[model samples]
Target: MAGKKRSFGRVRKLPSGRYQARYLGADGVDRPAPHTFRTKRDADDWLAERQAELRAGDWSDPDAGKIPFGTYAATWITERGIGASTADLYRSLLRNHLDPTFGTVAVADITSARVRAWRVARLDAGAGPSTVAKSYALLRAVLMTAVDDRLIRRNPCRVKGASSAVTPERPTATVQEVYAIADAIQPRYRALVLLAAFSGLRWGELIGLRRRDLDLTANTLRVRRNIAELHSGKRLIKEPKSAAGKRTVAIPAVILSDLSAHLTVFAEHGADGGVFIGAKGAAPRRNHFNRLWRKACHQAGIKGLHFHDLRHTGNTLAAATGASTRELMTRMGHSTARAALIYQHATAERERLIGNAVSAAVEQARKQAPGPNGHAAGT
Candidate 1:
């Protein structure tokens, strides 16, 4: 007798003595199993599973993610609409870290095991932890987009804690050390250093400032734009990274005269001219300023401090002055409280100083208090 008719697919015996499962997809195209099965029952089982998936509305096209990871990743970067500096960094990360291993791999074939092994290989290859973290984050982000686009069912980047770079606590400069470095630098960059250290302005913000942004009478500087310097020395002027990044920061009274001197001597003539420029009337480049910063650090006897640390120092100093977390966030141009909390943590020393002063005041009050009479107790 003939066997009962099958449901939605057919199992056929191949010439190689294996069974192949084939079915028609929603698009009326013949879809075959990715691989042959050992037995007709196995092929039928596979077909049943596919049918169930379609019935449950959980089916996705198996061939959709056949595109190469590199091609998709490059396209993802381009479509992201990121700034020039960010695009440059992403391209560098992809070229240096990611593309070598998974560039030609199908996006759907990137397994969690493969991702974990890649991370281990990167670490063994002596890639810095920070670089590895950044690469991992970029890879994860790309894969997430692939998932959202239905190119893949799930992202394979499941390595725990692989995205956060473990940066050590950055060293902060003392007030005298800040002054020494400012004084030791070229005269044109003196106010630059002072403003960065006191106002918590980033390198991009300081370089993007114009004469009109500075209100000397109000002692405040408006941060409306940021200039990103690409690896090729191309400068792209753009809006601040976030809305909170565009703010007016009050300059300390001590730095006003230095800023005035800088504006008069080194800044450009018109109101819209750059606030900080080189002696030759060119915009400041990070690479060029790095050399000057290193020399100034050496002359000032300060070591192992980065220019970004100047902003850190300023935030810590602001925290020490009893600024609230919101105030610190606004001053630091940060939208999140995590960075402000870091500066708040640095206020432990200030807490101790306050405690000591309070104890001393209490002691003096006790000493002057009357003891059983109107006379001073210590006297």
Candidate 2:
């Protein structure tokens, strides 16, 4: 039934006198190698390696990884305990980028070469670098889970630095530009422009705000929840993406009047009602907001500015306040220095002021120094 000795494998001679390698696995079932070897020694060697792996507790059950990549990947994504938006993103990437190639492929059959080939084909087929990178990263994460499950001994998505996308620097609007955009938008959304450019709130967080979220006297907005609008016109009010994302950001006192006016004129609901609303008294979704965003940019003479650029403008303005790196991170709800460091660079206006001050200092030094003789006595 089981092997003669549990520690070592038992070999048998096949019908054609070839040796067959078989071992009683941890499951107490006799399993043979995929192929028979010509010599007993060859079969013995294979069993020995398998035995060594078992002894070391590093043996991966071949049957464990027989699950299809798509099935297992979908399972992993669902049980990952991530946010809804994150799950939705993973599902999209798996469907759009990975499924065509690896859907029917067994997890055990996904070799490094196959993964590399899929990535190459995607890049050659006009997929953007960022898009491919995101998909590849998701693939890597799923394969890593397989490794943890002992379905695979190692992950095959091994292209180093393939996970990091080289994103172009986002354009930042100036203070005057932000004001112009605000003035050009519908009166109902004017405060939206000002708040986006001044408070540095993400669109999701801004649209999810209610009347009680704003503290006019304290000039602070509490970011408690965020809304993700689906393509089906459904909105999901979820917790902030990260622990740091649920933060209180202080609004500039300058926007106090504009915000007050917006509350009185536009926000007709009670304390628990949404701060921003459309004509139907519902919150503005992305598509509806996009139309207004386009109109405002067009009227402001800025042809290609996304709503996100206003947050960039606000972050740059905060940096201009000489805020420390930690301060910027807290304000922007970022946990990493990489994102904080982006706002550390001075804005164009601040740099101009520095340049002018440097020029004045040089002029004063030249005036004090003696001409040609380089003496302070002017000799």
Candidate 3:
């Protein structure tokens, strides 16, 4: 007797004694199973799973994820509407780290095991922790988009703690070292070094400063723009990273005269003129400044200090002044309290002062408290 008709798909015997399954998809196209099965029952079982997926609304076009990962990632980056500098960074990460592994692979073909292996290989190859973290984050972000697009069921970047990198502690410079570097550096950059250290202005903010942004009379420096210099020597001037980044920061009283001198002697002309510039009337480049920084450090007898250390020192010093977390966040141009809390370390000197104050408060309370019989406690 003839068998009962199948419901969703057709199973046919191949010439090699294998069974192939073909099914009509939601798109009204007949799609063959990717591989042949040894038995007709197995082929029917595979088709049954596809039918179940369709019924549950989890069915996706198998060909949709056939696009190469590199192609999808490039399109993803372009459609992200990110800033130029950020685009540059993502491109660099893709080119240097991710593309070599998954470039030609189909988006759906990437597996969690492959991702883990790739990360382990990168770590074994001596890639910096931060670089690896950034790359892994980028990979995960791209794969997540694929999942959203329904090109893949899930992201394969499932490694725990792979996106966070543990960077070593950054070194900070002292007041004496700051002055020594300032004096040792060229005359034009003297104010720049001192202002960076005291005002805690980032390199981009300092470079983007204009004459109109400074009001020495009020001892406040306005941060309106940030100049980012890419690795290719291209400069992009954009708004601050966050709303808090565009704020008015108090300039240290000691550096007011130096800033005045810098404006008069080195700064460009007009109210919109640049505040900090190179010796040849050009914007300061990071590479050029690094050479000058090295010489300055040598002359100052300071070692292992980065220019950012100056800002770190300033933040730490601000915290030392008993500045509240809100105050520190405002001064540091950070939108989050966690970023500010990192600088709020209690030094031994500050701890001692706090202890002394607490002890004094206790003594005063003891002296003023009423005794059991209504006499003063101390008496």
TM-score for all models, in order of appearance: 0.90, 0.86, 0.94
**Cα misplacement distance, residue 344 of candidate 3 (Å):** 1.2
State in Å the error of residue 24, model 1.
Answer: 1.1
Reference-based lDDT, residue 350, model 1:
89
lDDT of 1 at 286: 89
Sorted on lDDT, best first, the list reads: 3, 1, 2
Considering only N, C-alpha and C atoms within 3 Å, which residue pairs clash in candidate 2?
none
**lDDT (tens digit, per residue) of candidate 2 on 106-198:** 998999999999999999999989999999999999999899999998899899888877978778888888999889988899999999999
lDDT of each: 0.91, 0.88, 0.92
Give the per-residue lDDT of model 3 (tens digit) for 38-140.
9988998999999999999888898999999999999999999999899899999999889999999999999999999999999999999999999999999
Question: Considering TM-score, which of the candidate structures 2 and 3 is the better prediction for this target?
Answer: 3
The runs of at least 3 residues in candidate 3 whose Cα sits more than 4 Å from the true structure, single-residue gaps closed, are 1-5, 369-379
Candidate 3 TM-score over all chains jointly = 0.94
TM-score-best of 1 and 3 = 3
Clashing pairs in 1: none
Candidate 2 achieves a global lDDT of 0.88
- Top candidate on TM-score is 3
Pick out the ten consecutive residues of candidate 1 with the lowest summed lDDT. Answer: 1-10
**Candidate 2 regions off by >4 Å?**
1-7, 10-19, 230-233, 352-379
